[model samples]
Target: MPKIPECDRCRFYCGSHYLVCAVLPSGPDGKECHHFAPEPNAEPQELWEPQGARYIDDELVIERVTYNGEEIIQPPQRWSREKKLWLLDNHPMFTGLCPSCGAEFERDFTARVHWDCPECGWKDDSV
Candidate 1:
């Protein structure tokens, strides 16, 4: 009959066998069976370090570094006329203007789409 290893010396025979053990039996005394499991094809944990500002060269001298240099060209900003018109027509600040009294009114832009002029009580006119 094959003898089953005693639990007192077997590292694989833990109270809970939820995790698998890769360690082989050392000897009869089981002196090295203290949760000694070999990690097979396991990758090492990577530690992250914070990165700061980087420089190309340690000792680099600038001859003429102007704040507003002519060579420092900026790209022109792109705008849509149709979108601007739509925003102007739909915006609460512009659309809430009273036609009769010509007074600017405040309205909740997020809650409601329709706005009423506070001064003249006018309901519907595109500002």
Candidate 2:
């Protein structure tokens, strides 16, 4: 048996160490197996700013909507490299850089959102 990467996104690990089994088959060696199939990982999704007010069952939701008719949702705010560097220097939870482009941005955990990198359009979802 080969070591496999721990997958924390599977639902099977609901209790008892929350142990996630290897998604890959073939004994976790990336080999071929009859049951070999990629397990669904709960990868986070990007949250984009909505364009309009949303209503459900004739009830209005105010958490994500604005008071006016316009949808003033949370959009990425632009910051200069200096600002990013400052954040990197000061913040404790900043993580990984985008390889597509060398732009940096902060992840807001409280909001569960991330601002898109100004230099490149990289988005972080696990903020």
Residue 60 lDDT in candidate 1:
24
lDDT of 1 by residue, 45-125 (tens): 222322322222232222333356544323333445786776576545566655467777655655655567677676753
Maximum-TM-score candidate: 1
lDDT scores of the candidates, listed in order: 0.43, 0.43
Q: What is the C-alpha RMSD of each candidate to the true structure, in Å?
A: 20.7, 19.1
Which residues of candidate 2, in runs, are more than 4 Å off?
Answer: 1-96, 124-127
Clashing pairs in 2: none
Candidate 1, position 102, lDDT: 70
Give candidate 1 regions above 4 Å deviation: 1-96, 125-127
Task: Provide the global lDDT of candidate 1 against the true structure.
Answer: 0.43
Clashes of 1: 0
